[model samples]
Target: MTLYTFFGCLLTAYGPILSIFFLFIAKNAQHVLLTVASIAIQELFRWLYFLLMQRAEPGLNMVTKYPRSPFNRIIFAFVAGYGYALTTSLVSYVPILVESLGPGILMVPSFPAASTFFDAAVTTSFFSLLHMAWMVIAFDGFAAKKWVGSLKIGWVLASHLGASYSTLLNTSTIPFGCIYAMVIQIVFLLISVAIIVASLAKKR
Candidate 1:
Protein backbone atom coordinates (compact mmCIF):
# COMPACT_ATOMS: atom_id res chain seq x y z
CA MET A 1 0.00 0.00 0.00
CA THR A 2 2.85 2.35 0.72
CA LEU A 3 4.35 1.57 -2.64
CA TYR A 4 0.93 2.13 -4.17
CA THR A 5 0.80 5.59 -2.66
CA PHE A 6 4.29 6.44 -3.79
CA PHE A 7 3.39 5.64 -7.36
CA GLY A 8 0.13 7.52 -6.98
CA CYS A 9 2.06 10.58 -5.89
CA LEU A 10 4.26 10.30 -8.92
CA LEU A 11 1.27 10.11 -11.21
CA THR A 12 -0.45 12.96 -9.44
CA ALA A 13 2.54 15.12 -10.20
CA TYR A 14 2.27 14.35 -13.89
CA GLY A 15 -1.52 14.27 -14.11
CA PRO A 16 -1.93 17.99 -14.48
CA ILE A 17 0.46 18.12 -17.38
CA LEU A 18 -1.58 15.47 -19.14
CA SER A 19 -4.73 17.30 -18.19
CA ILE A 20 -3.43 20.27 -20.09
CA PHE A 21 -3.34 18.23 -23.28
CA PHE A 22 -6.65 16.59 -22.49
CA LEU A 23 -8.20 19.97 -21.91
CA PHE A 24 -7.62 21.05 -25.46
CA ILE A 25 -8.97 17.88 -27.10
CA ALA A 26 -11.63 16.56 -24.73
CA LYS A 27 -15.19 17.73 -24.93
CA ASN A 28 -18.45 17.00 -23.14
CA ALA A 29 -17.96 15.80 -19.57
CA GLN A 30 -14.21 16.20 -19.93
CA HIS A 31 -13.59 16.48 -16.21
CA VAL A 32 -15.54 13.33 -15.48
CA LEU A 33 -13.66 11.41 -18.13
CA LEU A 34 -10.40 12.72 -16.80
CA THR A 35 -11.26 11.56 -13.29
CA VAL A 36 -11.93 8.01 -14.46
CA ALA A 37 -8.83 7.96 -16.60
CA SER A 38 -6.75 9.21 -13.73
CA ILE A 39 -8.02 6.47 -11.45
CA ALA A 40 -7.31 3.81 -14.04
CA ILE A 41 -3.82 5.08 -14.64
CA GLN A 42 -3.11 5.22 -10.93
CA GLU A 43 -4.30 1.65 -10.40
CA LEU A 44 -2.15 0.38 -13.22
CA PHE A 45 0.85 2.20 -11.91
CA ARG A 46 0.19 0.97 -8.40
CA TRP A 47 0.12 -2.63 -9.55
CA LEU A 48 3.37 -2.28 -11.44
CA TYR A 49 4.95 -0.57 -8.48
CA PHE A 50 3.93 -3.42 -6.21
CA LEU A 51 5.55 -5.92 -8.53
CA LEU A 52 8.75 -3.92 -8.58
CA MET A 53 8.81 -3.57 -4.82
CA GLN A 54 8.27 -7.30 -4.35
CA ARG A 55 11.19 -7.99 -6.62
CA ALA A 56 13.43 -5.48 -4.92
CA GLU A 57 12.65 -6.46 -1.37
CA PRO A 58 11.94 -10.17 -1.25
CA GLY A 59 11.41 -9.83 2.47
CA LEU A 60 8.12 -8.07 1.84
CA ASN A 61 6.63 -11.49 1.11
CA MET A 62 7.05 -12.19 4.79
CA VAL A 63 4.20 -9.77 5.40
CA THR A 64 2.13 -12.83 6.11
CA LYS A 65 4.43 -14.08 8.87
CA TYR A 66 2.52 -15.23 11.91
CA PRO A 67 2.68 -13.90 15.50
CA ARG A 68 1.55 -10.51 14.26
CA SER A 69 -1.14 -9.42 16.66
CA PRO A 70 -4.35 -7.87 15.35
CA PHE A 71 -3.65 -4.76 17.37
CA ASN A 72 -0.33 -4.27 15.65
CA ARG A 73 -1.87 -4.90 12.25
CA ILE A 74 -4.52 -2.27 12.87
CA ILE A 75 -1.98 0.26 13.99
CA PHE A 76 0.28 -0.38 11.02
CA ALA A 77 -2.61 -0.08 8.60
CA PHE A 78 -3.86 3.18 10.07
CA VAL A 79 -0.42 4.68 10.10
CA ALA A 80 0.38 3.58 6.56
CA GLY A 81 -2.96 4.78 5.33
CA TYR A 82 -2.55 8.12 7.01
CA GLY A 83 0.92 8.49 5.55
CA TYR A 84 -0.38 7.72 2.07
CA ALA A 85 -3.17 10.23 2.48
CA LEU A 86 -0.82 12.89 3.72
CA THR A 87 1.57 12.45 0.82
CA THR A 88 -1.30 12.32 -1.66
CA SER A 89 -2.95 15.44 -0.32
CA LEU A 90 0.23 17.42 -0.16
CA VAL A 91 1.74 16.24 -3.43
CA SER A 92 -1.38 15.59 -5.51
CA TYR A 93 -4.48 17.32 -4.22
CA VAL A 94 -2.87 20.56 -3.13
CA PRO A 95 -1.76 21.51 -6.64
CA ILE A 96 -5.15 20.65 -8.08
CA LEU A 97 -6.81 22.63 -5.35
CA VAL A 98 -4.58 25.53 -6.20
CA GLU A 99 -5.31 25.17 -9.89
CA SER A 100 -9.01 25.05 -9.16
CA LEU A 101 -8.70 28.36 -7.41
CA GLY A 102 -7.60 29.98 -10.63
CA PRO A 103 -10.03 30.90 -13.44
CA GLY A 104 -11.24 27.33 -13.73
CA ILE A 105 -8.46 25.65 -15.70
CA LEU A 106 -9.92 23.89 -18.68
CA MET A 107 -10.84 20.27 -17.94
CA VAL A 108 -10.41 21.02 -14.28
CA PRO A 109 -13.45 22.33 -12.50
CA SER A 110 -12.86 24.79 -9.75
CA PHE A 111 -14.15 23.92 -6.35
CA PRO A 112 -14.92 26.30 -3.52
CA ALA A 113 -12.18 26.44 -0.90
CA ALA A 114 -14.42 24.85 1.68
CA SER A 115 -15.40 22.12 -0.73
CA THR A 116 -11.77 21.33 -1.51
CA PHE A 117 -10.85 21.05 2.14
CA PHE A 118 -13.93 18.97 2.91
CA ASP A 119 -13.20 16.64 0.04
CA ALA A 120 -9.60 16.25 1.13
CA ALA A 121 -10.46 15.51 4.73
CA VAL A 122 -13.17 13.03 3.84
CA THR A 123 -11.14 11.23 1.20
CA THR A 124 -8.09 10.96 3.45
CA SER A 125 -10.02 9.49 6.33
CA PHE A 126 -12.13 7.22 4.18
CA PHE A 127 -9.15 5.69 2.37
CA SER A 128 -7.26 5.35 5.64
CA LEU A 129 -10.09 3.35 7.14
CA LEU A 130 -10.38 1.30 4.01
CA HIS A 131 -6.68 0.46 4.20
CA MET A 132 -7.09 -0.62 7.79
CA ALA A 133 -9.87 -3.00 6.79
CA TRP A 134 -7.78 -4.38 3.96
CA MET A 135 -4.80 -5.01 6.22
CA VAL A 136 -6.86 -6.81 8.85
CA ILE A 137 -8.61 -9.04 6.34
CA ALA A 138 -5.46 -9.76 4.39
CA PHE A 139 -3.46 -10.63 7.49
CA ASP A 140 -6.21 -12.85 8.85
CA GLY A 141 -6.51 -14.70 5.60
CA PHE A 142 -2.76 -15.23 5.40
CA ALA A 143 -2.41 -16.34 9.00
CA ALA A 144 -5.09 -18.94 8.41
CA LYS A 145 -3.29 -20.05 5.25
CA LYS A 146 -6.44 -19.46 3.21
CA TRP A 147 -6.50 -18.90 -0.52
CA VAL A 148 -8.07 -15.55 0.24
CA GLY A 149 -4.65 -14.37 1.32
CA SER A 150 -3.35 -14.68 -2.21
CA LEU A 151 -5.98 -12.26 -3.40
CA LYS A 152 -5.29 -9.49 -0.92
CA ILE A 153 -3.15 -7.35 -3.22
CA GLY A 154 -5.62 -7.43 -6.07
CA TRP A 155 -8.50 -6.87 -3.69
CA VAL A 156 -6.91 -3.80 -2.16
CA LEU A 157 -6.22 -2.26 -5.56
CA ALA A 158 -9.71 -2.98 -6.83
CA SER A 159 -11.33 -1.66 -3.69
CA HIS A 160 -9.29 1.54 -3.78
CA LEU A 161 -10.18 2.16 -7.40
CA GLY A 162 -13.85 1.46 -6.83
CA ALA A 163 -14.03 3.65 -3.78
CA SER A 164 -12.27 6.51 -5.54
CA TYR A 165 -14.63 6.37 -8.50
CA SER A 166 -17.68 6.15 -6.29
CA THR A 167 -16.52 8.95 -4.07
CA LEU A 168 -15.93 11.22 -7.04
CA LEU A 169 -19.39 10.46 -8.38
CA ASN A 170 -21.05 10.86 -5.02
CA THR A 171 -19.38 14.13 -4.23
CA SER A 172 -21.85 16.04 -6.30
CA THR A 173 -24.83 14.27 -4.81
CA ILE A 174 -23.69 14.21 -1.18
CA PRO A 175 -22.32 17.75 -0.95
CA PHE A 176 -20.91 17.68 2.54
CA GLY A 177 -19.85 20.77 4.43
CA CYS A 178 -16.43 21.08 6.02
CA ILE A 179 -17.71 20.64 9.54
CA TYR A 180 -19.67 17.54 8.59
CA ALA A 181 -16.71 16.02 6.79
CA MET A 182 -14.43 16.70 9.74
CA VAL A 183 -16.90 15.11 12.11
CA ILE A 184 -17.17 12.04 9.94
CA GLN A 185 -13.37 11.72 9.71
CA ILE A 186 -13.03 12.03 13.47
CA VAL A 187 -15.72 9.42 14.03
CA PHE A 188 -13.97 6.98 11.72
CA LEU A 189 -10.66 7.51 13.48
CA LEU A 190 -12.25 6.97 16.87
CA ILE A 191 -14.04 3.83 15.73
CA SER A 192 -10.82 2.40 14.29
CA VAL A 193 -8.97 3.22 17.49
CA ALA A 194 -11.68 1.50 19.51
CA ILE A 195 -11.34 -1.60 17.37
CA ILE A 196 -7.59 -1.59 17.91
CA VAL A 197 -8.07 -1.31 21.64
CA ALA A 198 -10.53 -4.16 21.62
CA SER A 199 -8.06 -6.32 19.73
CA LEU A 200 -5.36 -5.52 22.25
CA ALA A 201 -7.63 -6.46 25.12
CA LYS A 202 -8.50 -9.72 23.42
CA LYS A 203 -4.82 -10.58 23.10
CA ARG A 204 -4.22 -9.74 26.75
Candidate 2:
Protein backbone atom coordinates (compact mmCIF):
# COMPACT_ATOMS: atom_id res chain seq x y z
CA MET A 1 0.00 0.00 0.00
CA THR A 2 2.83 2.37 0.78
CA LEU A 3 4.24 1.82 -2.69
CA TYR A 4 0.83 2.33 -4.24
CA THR A 5 0.33 5.68 -2.53
CA PHE A 6 3.79 6.71 -3.55
CA PHE A 7 3.02 5.97 -7.21
CA GLY A 8 -0.18 8.02 -7.13
CA CYS A 9 1.81 10.89 -5.73
CA LEU A 10 4.40 10.42 -8.44
CA LEU A 11 1.84 10.33 -11.25
CA THR A 12 0.29 13.55 -10.04
CA ALA A 13 3.62 15.27 -9.56
CA TYR A 14 5.55 14.26 -12.68
CA GLY A 15 2.79 13.27 -15.05
CA PRO A 16 4.83 14.93 -17.78
CA ILE A 17 7.46 12.23 -17.54
CA LEU A 18 5.14 9.84 -19.31
CA SER A 19 4.22 12.51 -21.79
CA ILE A 20 7.87 13.08 -22.55
CA PHE A 21 8.47 9.45 -23.33
CA PHE A 22 5.40 9.13 -25.52
CA LEU A 23 6.28 12.38 -27.25
CA PHE A 24 9.63 10.97 -28.20
CA ILE A 25 7.94 8.19 -30.09
CA ALA A 26 5.27 10.43 -31.54
CA LYS A 27 7.95 12.70 -32.94
CA ASN A 28 6.89 13.92 -36.39
CA ALA A 29 4.23 11.29 -36.93
CA GLN A 30 0.45 11.38 -37.20
CA HIS A 31 0.22 11.21 -33.44
CA VAL A 32 -3.18 12.81 -33.22
CA LEU A 33 -5.04 9.63 -34.13
CA LEU A 34 -2.35 7.42 -32.69
CA THR A 35 -2.45 9.25 -29.39
CA VAL A 36 -6.19 8.76 -29.10
CA ALA A 37 -5.88 5.17 -30.17
CA SER A 38 -3.03 4.47 -27.81
CA ILE A 39 -4.89 5.79 -24.80
CA ALA A 40 -8.03 3.95 -25.82
CA ILE A 41 -6.03 0.79 -26.13
CA GLN A 42 -4.34 1.38 -22.80
CA GLU A 43 -7.68 1.81 -21.04
CA LEU A 44 -9.19 -1.21 -22.72
CA PHE A 45 -6.21 -3.37 -21.96
CA ARG A 46 -6.25 -2.31 -18.32
CA TRP A 47 -9.75 -3.71 -17.85
CA LEU A 48 -9.31 -6.71 -20.10
CA TYR A 49 -6.10 -7.75 -18.45
CA PHE A 50 -7.68 -7.46 -15.04
CA LEU A 51 -10.60 -9.64 -16.08
CA LEU A 52 -8.36 -12.28 -17.56
CA MET A 53 -6.32 -12.45 -14.37
CA GLN A 54 -8.92 -11.65 -11.72
CA ARG A 55 -9.05 -14.08 -8.85
CA ALA A 56 -12.09 -15.68 -7.36
CA GLU A 57 -13.41 -13.32 -4.71
CA PRO A 58 -16.57 -12.80 -2.77
CA GLY A 59 -18.07 -9.57 -4.07
CA LEU A 60 -20.22 -7.93 -6.68
CA ASN A 61 -19.20 -7.20 -10.26
CA MET A 62 -17.16 -4.19 -9.14
CA VAL A 63 -16.65 -1.65 -6.37
CA THR A 64 -18.48 1.52 -5.47
CA LYS A 65 -17.03 4.99 -4.96
CA TYR A 66 -18.04 5.00 -1.29
CA PRO A 67 -18.22 1.40 -0.29
CA ARG A 68 -20.99 -0.06 1.79
CA SER A 69 -18.86 -3.10 2.54
CA PRO A 70 -15.31 -3.21 3.86
CA PHE A 71 -13.33 -0.86 1.68
CA ASN A 72 -9.89 -1.77 2.92
CA ARG A 73 -9.12 -3.93 -0.09
CA ILE A 74 -10.08 -1.22 -2.53
CA ILE A 75 -8.12 1.37 -0.58
CA PHE A 76 -5.12 -0.89 -0.65
CA ALA A 77 -5.31 -1.21 -4.44
CA PHE A 78 -5.53 2.55 -4.96
CA VAL A 79 -2.74 3.22 -2.51
CA ALA A 80 -0.56 0.58 -4.11
CA GLY A 81 -1.03 2.02 -7.60
CA TYR A 82 -0.51 5.56 -6.39
CA GLY A 83 2.63 4.56 -4.52
CA TYR A 84 4.15 2.89 -7.60
CA ALA A 85 3.53 6.00 -9.69
CA LEU A 86 4.91 8.26 -7.01
CA THR A 87 8.08 6.19 -6.60
CA THR A 88 8.70 6.05 -10.34
CA SER A 89 8.26 9.78 -10.72
CA LEU A 90 10.69 10.37 -7.88
CA VAL A 91 13.31 8.24 -9.61
CA SER A 92 12.54 9.35 -13.19
CA TYR A 93 15.07 12.18 -12.93
CA VAL A 94 17.90 9.68 -12.78
CA PRO A 95 17.80 9.06 -16.53
CA ILE A 96 18.68 12.67 -17.25
CA LEU A 97 21.51 12.34 -14.79
CA VAL A 98 22.76 9.27 -16.62
CA GLU A 99 23.02 11.26 -19.85
CA SER A 100 24.54 14.29 -18.10
CA LEU A 101 27.03 12.40 -15.90
CA GLY A 102 28.20 10.39 -18.91
CA PRO A 103 28.24 6.62 -19.33
CA GLY A 104 30.81 6.25 -16.52
CA ILE A 105 28.34 7.64 -13.99
CA LEU A 106 25.75 5.08 -15.05
CA MET A 107 27.79 2.43 -13.28
CA VAL A 108 26.84 3.87 -9.92
CA PRO A 109 23.68 2.54 -8.26
CA SER A 110 23.30 5.82 -6.43
CA PHE A 111 22.58 7.35 -9.81
CA PRO A 112 19.28 5.95 -11.07
CA ALA A 113 20.28 6.52 -14.69
CA ALA A 114 22.26 3.36 -14.14
CA SER A 115 18.89 1.79 -14.86
CA THR A 116 18.30 0.95 -18.50
CA PHE A 117 15.41 1.91 -20.75
CA PHE A 118 14.07 -1.61 -20.34
CA ASP A 119 14.08 -1.07 -16.60
CA ALA A 120 12.16 2.16 -16.98
CA ALA A 121 9.65 0.60 -19.33
CA VAL A 122 9.08 -2.32 -17.01
CA THR A 123 8.66 -0.08 -14.00
CA THR A 124 6.29 2.34 -15.69
CA SER A 125 4.12 -0.42 -17.09
CA PHE A 126 3.98 -2.17 -13.75
CA PHE A 127 3.00 1.07 -12.04
CA SER A 128 0.20 1.75 -14.53
CA LEU A 129 -1.17 -1.80 -14.38
CA LEU A 130 -1.19 -1.77 -10.60
CA HIS A 131 -2.89 1.59 -10.63
CA MET A 132 -5.65 0.29 -12.84
CA ALA A 133 -5.87 -3.02 -11.04
CA TRP A 134 -6.50 -1.18 -7.82
CA MET A 135 -9.11 0.93 -9.49
CA VAL A 136 -10.95 -2.16 -10.71
CA ILE A 137 -10.61 -3.72 -7.28
CA ALA A 138 -11.90 -0.58 -5.58
CA PHE A 139 -14.59 0.21 -8.08
CA ASP A 140 -16.01 -3.25 -8.05
CA GLY A 141 -18.07 -2.13 -5.11
CA PHE A 142 -19.13 1.11 -6.74
CA ALA A 143 -19.96 -0.90 -9.79
CA ALA A 144 -22.06 -3.06 -7.56
CA LYS A 145 -23.66 -0.16 -5.74
CA LYS A 146 -23.95 2.49 -8.42
CA TRP A 147 -21.76 4.70 -6.28
CA VAL A 148 -21.08 6.87 -9.28
CA GLY A 149 -24.11 8.95 -8.45
CA SER A 150 -21.80 11.93 -8.36
CA LEU A 151 -18.23 10.85 -9.00
CA LYS A 152 -17.39 9.91 -12.55
CA ILE A 153 -14.36 7.93 -13.60
CA GLY A 154 -14.83 9.58 -16.99
CA TRP A 155 -12.83 12.49 -15.63
CA VAL A 156 -9.82 10.23 -15.36
CA LEU A 157 -10.31 9.13 -18.93
CA ALA A 158 -10.57 12.71 -20.06
CA SER A 159 -7.45 13.73 -18.22
CA HIS A 160 -5.44 10.90 -19.67
CA LEU A 161 -6.72 11.61 -23.17
CA GLY A 162 -5.90 15.29 -22.91
CA ALA A 163 -2.45 14.56 -21.59
CA SER A 164 -1.85 12.11 -24.44
CA TYR A 165 -2.75 14.72 -27.05
CA SER A 166 -0.69 17.38 -25.35
CA THR A 167 2.29 15.08 -25.26
CA LEU A 168 1.72 14.15 -28.90
CA LEU A 169 2.04 17.81 -29.82
CA ASN A 170 5.31 18.02 -27.96
CA THR A 171 6.58 14.90 -29.73
CA SER A 172 5.60 16.12 -33.19
CA THR A 173 8.90 17.96 -33.60
CA ILE A 174 10.92 14.75 -33.85
CA PRO A 175 11.03 12.55 -36.95
CA PHE A 176 8.78 9.61 -36.24
CA GLY A 177 9.00 7.75 -39.52
CA CYS A 178 12.35 6.09 -39.09
CA ILE A 179 13.93 2.75 -38.28
CA TYR A 180 14.99 3.93 -34.83
CA ALA A 181 11.52 5.18 -34.08
CA MET A 182 9.98 1.88 -35.09
CA VAL A 183 12.48 0.00 -32.98
CA ILE A 184 11.78 2.23 -30.03
CA GLN A 185 8.04 1.71 -30.32
CA ILE A 186 8.49 -2.01 -30.51
CA VAL A 187 10.76 -2.06 -27.48
CA PHE A 188 8.43 0.14 -25.52
CA LEU A 189 5.50 -2.13 -26.23
CA LEU A 190 7.48 -5.18 -25.29
CA ILE A 191 8.61 -3.66 -22.02
CA SER A 192 5.10 -2.51 -21.26
CA VAL A 193 3.78 -6.01 -21.88
CA ALA A 194 6.40 -7.38 -19.54
CA ILE A 195 5.26 -4.97 -16.86
CA ILE A 196 1.66 -6.03 -17.27
CA VAL A 197 2.65 -9.67 -17.06
CA ALA A 198 4.62 -9.00 -13.88
CA SER A 199 1.66 -7.24 -12.29
CA LEU A 200 -0.71 -10.04 -13.23
CA ALA A 201 1.65 -12.55 -11.66
CA LYS A 202 1.39 -10.62 -8.42
CA LYS A 203 -2.35 -11.31 -8.35
CA ARG A 204 -1.64 -14.99 -8.18
Top candidate by lDDT? 1
Model 2 CA deviation exceeding 4 Å by range? 1-43, 49-54, 59-69, 79-94, 103-151, 168-204
lDDT of 1 by residue, 1-204 (tens): 243443454354434433433563233243233223333223235434333333533343244344344443433333333333334545645554454444432321233443343355345545545544544433333333355445555555555555555545333534443345445444544554554455457656
lDDT of each: 0.42, 0.38
lDDT of each residue in 83-190, candidate 2, tens digit only: 334444446634532343333322222223323332343344444543434344433423433544113245334434443343232223344222233344344334
Clashes of 1: 0
Worst 10 residues of 2 by lDDT: 105-114
Q: Where does candidate 1 clash, by residue pair?
A: none
Worst 10 residues of 1 by lDDT: 104-113
